[model samples]
Target: MMATVRNPARDAVAFVGVGTTPYLRDAGGKSATALACDAARTAIEDAGVDLADIDGICGSSVPTVSVQAALGLPAVTWWSNSSLPFSLLVIEAMNAVFSGACTTVLVYHSSLRGAGGSKTAAADPFRVHNASDAHGHNAAMTAESPSGTYGYCAWAQRYLDTYGVGRDALGLVAINGRANAARNPHALFREPLSMEQYLGARMIREPLCVLDMDPPVDAGDAFVLTTAERARDLGHRPVLLHAATSGRTDRPFADQLEDYTISGKEIVAWRLWEKSDVALSDVDVFFPYDGFSIMALSWVEAVGYCQPGEAGPFLAKHWSAGENRVLIDGRVPINTHGGSLSEGATQGAGHFREAVTQLRGDAGERQVPGAATALVTPGGFLWNATGFVLRGG
Candidate 1:
């Protein structure tokens, strides 16, 4: 059954706090819960609010209860205790906020599994087919990749055949991320990436090179959500959560998708537009998921910023170190914090934290000037996606 639970809208829900453990490829000294607590503590302090006010807590589905015990999380008004992706947790956290069950909400994720560990011999059954893959990145599939080990490749190859997308087009994506990551201090890969390096990178899946996948990393991140009115009392700037949207159909995976070119993330844009007054042109920054490069391009198109099949050219023609027309006259930033592909994946919570940073004007060197509006997205598996358009109002 679908988790279509909806919470009634309040006057407004705002993100008053955000925090994270330093982004690291491997945090050997830190346990996932330790990172999670650090992030949660930073958020609580940043908001200048006490934990007593936060009655609701939602978390990414890692294999631990330390987060619950650490924060003394009360019974979650809307808990998703499954291996659902990060985007789902954000959507559910918003639901709890809207339900009037809690004025302040803390959402967190921490994990060591993502820290470059090889899957054990008796790994999760889902990863059996992907064990021999060049890299472990694609050793599992979301609902979108129904072919299991080969589903992401299947979708990418279809995009190439139908759209005539060349291997160079994929290079364009890596280049965009690499350039942005270079400016991101929190990013793991801060070095410059050339087309040669990206193209020559080990092939993970047939069409997806190593550069296209997110490197495994260990870390944690957290966000605090409360009403705009309540947030006003807090010391931090409140980035209004204009809307939170989730979309899916009753299908199993990519095999059942009606259109290979259109995924659930595209549908999230449609829902985002339906709920907010923000226009596509008004978006100051975009934090679309960078778990995979192809998905990032798809989200750019899905969000209506560019037409379908136009992202390859958009990134190739417009992105450069000193020139990026997409954001602020070649200076407007995207994924300024480098995102999952470069910054390291913290079970998707990383994206949400970056969005908060941009909104709070705390994004250090990569900060977008006068960035009052930002869009954050998390997507995976077929038809499973979440969207948030945050504005500093």
Candidate 2:
């Protein structure tokens, strides 16, 4: 028998405030650092905390010094740039708070993809050029297609081939996101998406139309974390950080993954349950990162909401019903504030904000009734996945 690893810091920290800059196709002339500062200020104001009170900061894809100076913090006791997945950045902030290294911490993310900058560009300096760079890479040579669409296209095709599922199964995921986005005033795309539009849309990659992929945008999102006791004394309702855990699969490489259908989210989900008192049944809302429709579908199964290969049918039945099963009043409301797919892409930070808002009853039109518990899964690619369980305090 194996012993379970429990998080002793469970519920020790709470997200007191969340903020975001306008999700825009182009940020005009604003730099990513400036956008991050705007979001940080908003979060601090929402938390009712003075800028001087923030002793720690964590971020991904942005400079800590720039944000620190821009915010005019007196001094930073602890600061780091994880550059890891955005969800892991949240866990790092929680760990800093739990260790008494800082009292109030801010975690933020910003992207200039719309400005023609991308993660791949930033990582290029660190990557060693291979033959595939000069010659085009193929889908079968998974690890070699770092900058191409073949990797994702291959995954989508594999899922379809293995389950004998149609492309519509993936289309439903996009439709659900668009429906939720229609209710969000801040979402970039508010127009209603129809099944006909989805099926007829131009294909970016085989089996994946334009709507199935996440659009790149310039945006920033920030969150404030403090001790639960302190959070309760702050301006807004504190959403308890019940659990935060991340894990990787044995096969970390894209081309070498043992099983394409099995996302390592199962490992994250099991670990989250082991650390929290709440169960999946008690969850009132869900916010899974929708970098791609298939990624969201993988999380749906990884979290044990349905068995593997069942998400296609489950979504088809629930997503299309007249009752709007994926809405806030429906059986299990998901991505109530839209998602990266429909909402602006703030990496995974937008998902964090949605969870906090839903838990606080601050999501205006998409607010779930009595949403006391929320589950947020942030995942990308095959193995890197993290889950956060939040409860209203």
**TM-score winner:** 2
Q: What is the C-alpha RMSD of each candidate to the true structure, in Å?
A: 4.9, 4.9
For residues 269-342, write the lDDT of model 1, one tens digit per residue.
Answer: 77777777778678888887767777777777788767766778766655654543235335445566666777
**Which parts of model 2 have CA positions greater than 4 angstroms off?**
1-3, 114-149, 323-329
Collision count of model 2: 0
Candidate 2, lDDT over the whole model? 0.78
Per-candidate TM equals: 0.85, 0.90
Tens-place lDDT per residue, model 2, 114-217, is 31234553344322221112112323455446432455667878888888888888877777888888888888987877778989998877888788777766
lDDT of 2 at 165: 86
lDDT of 2 at 268: 82
Report the lDDT of model 2 for residue 1: 18
